[model samples]
Target: MMNIMRNSKHPVRTAAKEASHERIVSAAARAIRRSGYDGTGVADIMKEAGLTHGAFYAHFASREAMLAEAAERACTESAAIAAEAAASVPREQALTYMLHAYLSRENLEQVERGCPLAALGSETARQTPEVRRANTRYIKEMVDLVARQSPDWGQAGAHERALVTVATMVGTLLLARVVDEPALSDSLREAALKHLPIA
Candidate 1:
């Protein structure tokens, strides 16, 4: 079957258009990562993406649509690893990688485009119901992926773990970026990872 949605009024994601759209979405993701959804404006996203403001409408109906896509994209980025990270280690180690990746200084510094949780959690709370649902599904999937390691764990177990992981990461990154000192930033990473593999 064909992807009718892919070929909607939106231009084709051909070799040419694909790169630009990817750039726009990735740029917007990065902006949201750095500036927060409300903080990052369309023009700023476009400029950061290296495209002009006029081109954004062609890719998305509005910023929410972009955020929706960004949320999906961010989840997609983490989903693959969620499985792989858990494969070799016990459930907790996998959790460490998943949570660690999100809360690290490397992630906070990148901003503009990193973990969706750190980049857009608050904004997502304010999003349209549809977007919120999408985010919910993404979070559930990630939780399930981690819970897989504990064959005995139930849905509630997975759900709570996922919530803790996502919350830990988001809060850590938020505080990490807020501080002016490098040690403070490293301290946040250490604090978040304290319960994970290293500690």
Candidate 2:
């Protein structure tokens, strides 16, 4: 005799599994924001999600897998910010606003909850090949997002602008962290902001 299987209930189960997977990814995002990829261990991520370390493999092949996903999430969030910055009333104004927002004191103090470049950009190049690949894609997407918003600009213009934006934002944050001085930090951030192509 042959048996028939039901797939309706199966869909619901699949949804539940997907929800759990998202939960794990989100937990990793939060932990990574605070401790960064290398500093955040699987046990801590699972604990943050109120889960067990043993259960992690059910969602990811390894900690590296989790970092890859979390890194993408973090970078994706920054890309969204870039897109929004580009969407401001005037295209040129958008880039300038993004420049200011990205290098602000608020963003600098919250390293984990900030741009992956600012949080882990300098180190990402040294991670596993998979991580480096993921970071590269993340960066290109961010540049594309910024470019998409300012069509009044050409590809060369957009490319140069994106490079400048990323470089300034990354440099400002690193300096702020290294000097760890509020006055110097705020001034450096303003100096970067002052150089934007705001109109």
lDDT of each: 0.69, 0.74
lDDT of 1 by residue, 25-44 (tens): 77765566667667868888
Regions of candidate 2 where Cα sits further than 4 Å from its true position: 1-6, 147-152, 155-157, 196-199
The collision pairs in model 2 are 33-112
lDDT of 1 at 87: 71
Q: Which candidate's lDDT is highest?
A: 2
Scored against the true structure, residue 91 in model 1 reaches a CA lDDT of: 56
* lDDT per residue as tens, model 2, 1-199: 1222565667888898788778788878767767767788988888877787898998899888888888777777777776776676576567666777778777888776677777764677767777677678877876665665565455688677766667777778778766857898888888877875432
Worst 10 residues of 2 by lDDT: 1-10
User: Which candidate ranks first by TM-score, i.e. highest?
Assistant: 2
TM-score of each: 0.70, 0.85
TM-score of 2: 0.85
